[model samples]
Target: KSKVSVIETWLRKHRLLYVGATRHPFIHSIRDGSVDVSSFKRWLEQDYIFVRAFVPFVATVLLKAWKESFDATDMDVILSGMASLNDEFAWFNKEASKWGVSLTNVAPQKANLDYCRFLESLMSSEVEYTVAITAFWAIETVYQDSFAHCLEDGSNTPEELRDTCQRWGNDGFGQYCHALQSIAEHHLEKASDDVRKRTEAAVLDVLEYEVAFWNMSQGDT
Candidate 1:
């Protein structure tokens, strides 16, 4: 299964943990149906925004890295990749703009420093949803506690930040999905079967790690 599917399965199977009386009561209410899941749906929408904001930045960095790794003479491959990546980014940019988000220069703000750090931590290791809602919880906490400050002083509003976080999370997820799809497409072609399987498995492993990281009921890492 794709990482997204695996993560979704984990979310459905797990009971997220919360801390303190406030958290306990909030969790109870949600689990007991007093709070409902409408807000969760909206929060989930933020995932797309996150993907829209950072994918281009990442693609650009990757292109440069690829250039450094290969010869400058391989301009054709680099150009083709750039073209494909540009098309993808353009599509995401249009989507983000419709959501009132632009990725032109979304520098990492002070408030988002922790968010970035936490994401880096996850990316550095092979941990799964054991982190639970480390990313989500961080964004939610920021939203509930410091969103106003972010809106007044940051590049995007509190809603935008939350949306962006979710989008990034989803993009990580989409990467795994895309990798798997690529593997499957190649599998049908009977070319480099071993490489395709390795790529698919690697993406699945990443997806598993993400799922484990997000499934933590204990709240922030």
Candidate 2:
């Protein structure tokens, strides 16, 4: 309870992701329900494109679990997440309709493209399992904490978007982040110093990209 895990503690000390998470105006807008429909539509559409690219990154993670030393339970959890993404996609489309945004014609913005490229590079077979999984855990935990914070008792998040916030911020997803943290810490325990360094460096890059992503969402970048 003191910390989500050693990795989470390390990430906290890193502080880069925390800055990225809390500094984004889009996040503040979400907390205050001040985000306009157009901005939300931009995010929803571009994220749909990002998610399309994200699917393969996740698929690569699944392959890593199979080929690496990860257990069956790990695979089960990943597969379950994979299955839910279909529903997540459908949700985006539904939300897009509500806002009159067209996901089909949308393109990934510069920040999103850069992040996707990083994710694609991770698919290289030469990357170690520990490093790959750490990236996974970092990205997921960022979203979990970012959105979950919006649901804090006084968040004042808009009624219409509360469910969207809950998609990642819910208690269930917090447990999921804890599980991912456990996995990342488990691997870090056995990781060589070089791998640990690489993991931390990759996490820094992720944080930067996340900030860029939020900037893009707010049309600031």
Candidate 3:
């Protein structure tokens, strides 16, 4: 796509979250040739990756359900802003529909103490909250494509289809798992070693199980 097309599409997907006041300091900077498109694109790309990686991890670890919807916070609004831009994203909606899956919600749940502790630790600080919220925005916008799909030629049976969906979901969950690990690592300079190690293990366990689950599918058929 042309740069204009890309920009237009991005705008459509994220216009809702854009600061609209032309007189705003940031807006003025951008309009006055200070902030450039490259800088803006960098931020957009980082937010996209963070959300894609973390959202599912939060859902699986915290919510325990694969197909959950998140609350419409500013994060959700940002995601909607980016998704509004192009017809290509419609394919994601269709693919998800095939398995009747959606993004997981970020609400409280009684999964496990370790999981709860990890989440609480992240949210306890305002800095971590900002990181997580930015990550969530990217996920709300574009993380559905990380997982692989079953062959579309109908060579697989319904049972195979279910297994494929499970495997794919696990793959997506693994990305989220990595996000947790990355965040813990990023914050470790401030956290105790014991706390850091424990948190890292908790996140790694989730990712490890997901890898095992996906690999196990290979042996099934």
Q: TM-scores of all models?
A: 0.27, 0.93, 0.27
Q: Give the per-residue lDDT of model 2 (tens digit) for 1-221.
A: 46365575675798766766654789888988888777777878888888887788878888988988647777776676687688899889888877788888677789999999999888888888888888887787778888887899888898888878888888987887677777778888888999898888887787888888888888887
lDDT of each: 0.35, 0.80, 0.34
> For model 2, how big is the CA root-mean-square deviation?
2.1
Q: Runs in model 2 with CA error above 4 Å?
A: 1-5
Q: Comparing 1 and 2 by TM-score, which wins? A: 2
RMSD of each: 13.5, 2.1, 19.4
What lDDT score goes with residue 42 in model 1? 30
Which prediction has more favorable TM-score, 2 or 3?
2
Count residue pairs with overlapping backbones in model 3. Answer: 5
lDDT score, residue 211, model 3? 31
Clashing pairs in 2: none
Native-structure RMSD, model 3: 19.4
Query: What is candidate 2's TM-score against the reference?
Result: 0.93
